[model samples]
Target: MSFESEESKKLGGIKLSTLTQRLAYAGIKEQKAALSRKATDNNIKQIQAAIMLQFGKLPAPAKIWANVRHKDFTRQVRNFMWKSIHSAHRIGTFWKHIPECEDRGICQFCNEPEDLEHIVLKCRRPGQKEIWALAKELWLKKHPSWPVLSLGSILGCGLTTFRNNNGQPLVGASRLYRILISESLFMIWKIRNNSVIKREGAAVPAHEIHNKWLYAINLRLNFDRALTNHAKFGKQNSIKTPLVLQTWSSTLMEEDKLPENWIRAPRVLVGTEQQSSHHPSPPPGRRGRNR
Candidate 1:
């Protein structure tokens, strides 16, 4: 039977069923129209902005559905935004291992809704400051002019490429910035979990976290060096240049003071001689340095 006929029969002369069906359909139609109108208005505003800046403009209706034709651009924008907002998933199996908080189902470290923001930015656990400080340093290295606020803003800006006043792309140093941002956040989350779950009440030291970050940075720099060397010499067997290695190694050791044993390593002897003699050694007559 036709829908109209079925509705009429169900109403039994009152037509209540038909009326209800019509009302529901009308409500859906109105909602669609309202959303279309809102999109149309937004497009108009964007067009106006473009026209004022003499960059050409899209018609209101066309702009509203531009994603249909410009699928790649739309998808790239969507993915970039998604990654910027959700960068905490970089560490292998870190989030997966986070047990639900007993009280509010939150991650025990960050304690703010148990999501990316909480774990990286809002976590109040000890030694969290080091992760935040490292993140800030990375940001400043990439964007000297950017204002440092919460970790979320830092990651967002790092992941996104913005146009300057002159329409230049003010992005991070490289595409690898996304990976670095994710790794840093994941490292913080892992350290927090390790301290809370395995170590009981013992906190992960900030210096340890910094060392891990430096190691990751050094590994990436070395990989880059190897790739560049291979490209330049057209041979994988060719060793990386001492100059490039020296530059990267110095950068890795910039903030870290290596132990006496590390300082005396064969590789260290070939590099810079500016190594710090102070390696967290015990006080003159004391056992180990106080915790």
Candidate 2:
């Protein structure tokens, strides 16, 4: 079919760029506007100060912000992100603001406010700190140059800014990074909720959390393989440099059937192009000496 509109022909099909990055929680602007209106009576510079102090200056409204959460996550994961961002969860602090709720608004594990931030970032509850430490250890393997996370980054780590050594942007890395961050966030929340609401023992140990994350990754890899009908028989590991491998190389290198890929072919490294034709021998002294 021929083009029906001149605008379609005027420029090759390309979506307009976004200069704003609003989270667009259901009634966020109305909430912020309400805060502004209330600020005159009370010293609440609500919209500007709260967001800036907590999450740095908000970026211009960008679809990528929402895309990163929704596209990369299942329905439950998306729901979790939305609820946390909008402060609509059933945490005690939310109930505390009510005029006559029975909630004390303090963490059972640690005697502090039970707000989401306190739970995710400041809770020194036994297992919580260890889980974050383990996450930090894995995150460092992919981004060693990055520094410690601030309070905002810990809470909204899925949207944390990411780059590599030499300030080079790691293309396509954010999706995997978001997965890593989101998975850990959800896991922590699950552990805490189970303990408090369900009376299901204490928060899980860090080692268990680590293993659970690995299992989740492996399950995802297997699903990707099945979805794409990738054959197992191959001379090369297709997932060697794949994003999962790149992000979790420190741990995945030791795994046997990792990073299953749809394209089952040998991925050649750039510098190893000549190595296929040329095999190198270790200098003679070390090999002979061991023998």
Candidate 3:
């Protein structure tokens, strides 16, 4: 959509060049205003250059900033780029709002708040240290040039899914990276909540969080596996059955003798039988049965 709409003009003084540029500019202005400062001409110009670097050069800064203010950018840039530049400094401050996380006096996991850093970086949870270490190790193995070890860097790198050794995209690497980062964040969040809200003195076991992270990564990578194998793993893990399971289950039930409650119902039996059938049933009946 064009960023030069009448509504955008009314909200901000100028019309924008492109929707993306406008959106980026608007974000910077809004964040500056939210912090109780105006984006002066000089600051606006600098930000315009930054935006250009972030996204190619724009026709005009005023137009781009207007769009950014209106929040017209895509989610990827808005969440990752726009917010990263403006909100990164506030992360520690943001965590303070999490009740159990407020006191920086002691480590949340150890109840020693003495020198607690964010759970993602320096968690005191029982096995968290080991898991973080392993995550860092794995990340470095993929990105040896990365210098520091911090949750933000790890998360940022994972979200971007930086290129692999051969530069040919690693199949499912981006998804796997996201899964790893998400699992790590979730575990850290849970540990914080358990320590602060539940008053649990015990730290979250590192091995458990590591296993969870690994499971998430594996699941993302193996998403295209055969239904039978997926179901087998799902049942073993007690995870909910995916939609494919239901569709394949009814067809195969006649042939396969899988435990009735398997989460990822096997499709092998059903698919094989269907292949041998001379006449497949009507669509309506088949659809209803599958459902």
Q: Per-prediction TM-score, please?
A: 0.43, 0.57, 0.38
lDDT (CA) for every model shown?
Answer: 0.45, 0.50, 0.42
Clashing pairs in 2: 20-60, 20-61, 20-62, 21-59, 21-60, 21-61, 21-62, 22-61
Q: lDDT, candidate 2, residue 146?
A: 31
Model 3 scores a C-alpha lDDT of 0.42
Sort every candidate by TM-score, greatest first. 2, 1, 3
> For candidate 3, what is the TM-score?
0.38
* Candidates in order: C-alpha RMSD to true structure: 12.8, 18.9, 19.4
For residues 218-249, could you state the per-residue lDDT of candidate 1 as single tens digits? 45455545544565667644434543333333
Q: Give candidate 3 misplaced runs (Cα > 4 Å).
A: 1-117, 134-148, 158-161, 164-168, 171-175, 218-291
Model 1 has a clash total of 1
| Pairwise TM-score winner, candidates 1 and 3 | 1
lDDT of 2 by residue, 83-193 (tens): 665566767555665777635567867877787777766787644554555555455545544334443444344444455667665644555556655666777787777
Ranking by lDDT: 2, 1, 3
